[model samples]
Target: MTHSPQLWQPLQYGTAEWQRVYFRLRNAIEGMNGFGKDPLYECLESGGTHRIRGIAAQAVLVAFQLAHANKRKLATWAGSIAVDGNRPHRRATRRRKTKPLGSWNHEGYLTEPSE
Candidate 1:
């Protein structure tokens, strides 16, 4: 067994397919976390707004919050894909500056998904 398993994985980890798949999945997760923590959208931070007590109450609150967040995300996505006349036009994606890290991005991918 290797002393550090992370450094030993040298298979198909550096391929473009790997980067695209990993980044798409990772962006979804980070996007949700950022959306939930956003001040204008949600108040998920500690000592921010709510003062509810107990685990059950907190869980319920969070569940409802996430549900609302989902609805908002869906609405925003729909608006982005809104059609004009008879044609269905997709929203243009913004181009990002080149990052020093791999295609997965440095800030978003806190850790490797898997090798």
Candidate 2:
């Protein structure tokens, strides 16, 4: 692993609380998400909490925490959902229908873009 900035930095890794939370999340992800057999599980098993900031910070934190504890793949998926606001997959087109973006109305002004 390179020494560049990681996606998440450890706030405290060796603490008892961190270990407890990490193991709990790992078990939950493995048992609940069926990712126990994935290969990325070992890479994301480092026990630590991350400090995130922004509109979806909490959700991202939850995802990282899950990744740290359970399965990295599921955690990555969760992070993707949060980042994309749950956009539908492109390949699964038949199951989804496209809709026009909602019009925005602010300060008695209607902002409707031309189709």
Candidate 3:
């Protein structure tokens, strides 16, 4: 049996499969761009000039920003898993004791009963 090229041809633009793939690719690209602009990356806002002078410099800056973004993404992922109670490997930490502000005595004024 001969396989026709049309069998593997790309989906039509307005088709459901095409739209689903297009939206997934578009969202992935936009999400990465947003991550690069996030405070942790900051490369988009770093330099005094909006444009880099050399292609090498621009490439280096972008590479650095992508590395930092990846690092931050991994850190956040790890932290989430570490704190997730559903994860059996999650580590337990001591909770800090906190007191309400109303229980404190400021100067001569008592915020709450001293007892």
lDDT of 3 at 110: 45
Candidate order by TM-score, decreasing, is 3, 1, 2
Best TM-score goes to which candidate?
3
Candidate 2 per-residue lDDT over residues 1-115, each given as its tens digit: 6555765556468688888889998997666554533345532333333345665975676576555655555555665553446663333336566443455465645576778
Evaluate model 3: give its lDDT: 0.73
Residue 34, model 1: lDDT of: 84
| Residue pairs with clashing backbones, model 2 | 26-69, 26-70
The regions of model 3 sitting more than 4 angstroms off are: 1-10, 45-52, 82-115
CA lDDT of each prediction against the hidden true structure: 0.74, 0.56, 0.73
lDDT of 3 by residue, 1-115 (tens): 8758877657777899999999999998988788777754455655653367888988887787788888877776776663545753544788898776676676745475557
Whole-model lDDT, model 1? 0.74
Off by over 4 Å in 2: 1-10, 33-115
Instruction: Please report how far candidate 3 places residue 91 from its true position, in Å.
Output: 14
Q: List residue ranges in candidate 1 displaced over 4 A.
A: 1-20, 84-115
Distance (Å) between predicted and true CA of 25, model 2? 0.5
